[model samples]
Target: MSTPTASRQDPSPATDAWLVIPLYNEAQVIGSVIGAARGTFPHIVAVDDGSRDDSARQAERAGAIVVRHPVNRGQGAALQTGIDYVLDRTNADYIVTFDADGQHSPDDARAMVSAAREEGLGFVLGSRFLEGPSPVGPAKRFILGLAAKVSSRSSGMRMTDAHNGLRVLRRDAAERINLQQDRMAHASEIIRQLAATGLPWREHPVTITYTDYSRAKGQSLWNSINILVDLLFS
Candidate 1:
């Protein structure tokens, strides 16, 4: 499987994409993730969504501009915050929404950003299922695949994955998107909105390393239930 770590020879992403990471209580792995990402993408914004741990400090120390949410707003909210910050603060052409956990790879991020820039796509979504089987359990994969189907049906865009956290968006597309669902359901909401607005989009094959820490930190079964309920009713 292709690893997601960026190579030194690859064109730097700092000039192309503004990285945004939204995490809550990711103290253990966020530091290293930010440090590694900073090597390729220097302009990074990490949103600490009311984390009680040292997540903000670690990201700050790793050279990320930290944005703090006094209350734990969901990942969607944090991402929007980071995006808004970058749009208002910098003249960035592209915005990359990256997972705060160590699951996402910087190499894949760079490729997606490069793809968006070269192809002139308004949105680039990373898909783990495009190449081969994901590095996760069968049950988890099934659930995620079901969620992808749900998103596809709602959005009218047929794709292999929808809940993937890695994405690159053009400035105009990023500015137009509004994430109403603040929690897990926000993933599907994003797809639905993008499709609704008719953005030029593409999905790129990417890697997701599902470690024990990431697995533990992921949404629980009940959270999944809540997400489905929210998607269905709200």
Candidate 2:
């Protein structure tokens, strides 16, 4: 993967594809993620979801347009905030969602946007299973990948990574995907909305990091069963 930039000048994103990062207590890696994104895109918004740490301040220091939540909303809510901010404040043609724990690659962001534009795909999901050399453990690789396949089949999408945060959405599609779930279940909700809308969707390969920080903060394998149960029951 290409090295992320520590700081960079402003550069326009492809067709105004704004990058939106939803963060919790990710002060440790938020600055690096923003800096790595650099001038690669013009609008990079970081939504701090009521983190106990100084995540919002660090994101602002890294030159990102930061938004804050008064209370601890979940990741889905934070992402929704960023999406709404870009749609309301910026003339963005596309919106890309990314993780703030340095798990996602900034360079792959452009590729996802390009693919969305070229294929008229309303949503471009970043698929780890479609790519090579993932940092995910074997157990997670089996459970999540299997769940994704099942969900894709149910939703009529041929996706391989439904849980990955690295996704590019067309403006209309982004606006349409109103997340109802505030927690981990939001991932399934988003995909369900996409399937319900019957919007053109595609998946692109992306690299994700599995550092100790990410693994610690990430959802556990046990939670995977809960997510599926939520999807089934709701």
Candidate 3:
């Protein structure tokens, strides 16, 4: 088995890399996740996409810069809002879009930022497929792996984890991402956009913990089929 990469500190200083977390109805996990991320990244921005629960308050209490939307928007929309906040509020050199759940690790967060800084890549994706401790079940893994392959073929990027949300993007590449779909398909669309724009991108393996809570919040098997159907039909 391949060993985990050594954790390297971000050489670009603390204020350059901003962690952007978009959440909806993740009150149960938001606080803990924010606290965990805060251990590594100082600038953590959490966008509450009109969650019905008290996710915003939890994030704020956990030391995240909370930005609340008035109505429930999709994950893609929430991500866009967070990106906008990063562009407007801070002079961030790199922006990392992290999940609100505990699937992503703080070690991987720092590594991703460091990779982006050192490698001069426009974006770096935390690929669960390449990374160890991938928590997805066999069936879901097969489906997602196949989808990622298809996305790679379509985008000509040879990406390992096209749909993983834990990713870091340079300021220019991130600002160029315009999410057209408000739903889960935005994951695939992002690859397409990056490919079309010829952005320098790389994928690094990271651990994914598929707890019962995260599984419940994740895209359903039915939703996967719906995403493809929407992409094909639209």
Ranking 1 against 3 by lDDT, winner:
1
Clashing pairs in 3: 131-205
Which prediction has more favorable lDDT, 1 or 2? 1
| Candidate 1 lDDT by residue in tens digits, 1-234 | 122332233665568678999979999989899988887898999999999999999999889999999999999899889989999999999999999888888888888887666666788889989887677556656777777787788778887788788998889888888887788778878877778767677888889887778768864455555666666666
Looking at model 1, report the run of 10 residues with the lowest lDDT sum. Answer: 1-10
Candidate 3, residue 196: the lDDT equals 74
**Backbone clash count, each prediction separately:** 0, 1, 1
Q: Which of the two candidates, 2 or 3, achieves a greater TM-score against the reference?
A: 3
Model 2 TM-score, 2 decimals: 0.89
Stretches of model 2 off by over 4 angstroms after superposition: 1-15, 223-226
Residues 1-234 of candidate 2 have per-residue lDDT tens digits of 111122222235564788899988999989988998865765798988989998999999998998999999898898889999998998888999988988888778888787776666787888887756886768877878777877787787777787888988899888888998888878888888878876777777788877778778865677767666766665
Where does candidate 2 have its weakest 10-residue lDDT segment?
1-10
lDDT of 1 at 101: 84
Write down the RMSD of all candidates, one decimal each.
3.9, 5.3, 3.2
Candidate 3 lDDT tens digits, 1-111: 122345466533356788889889999999999887776788999989989999999999999999888998788888888889999888999899889988888777788
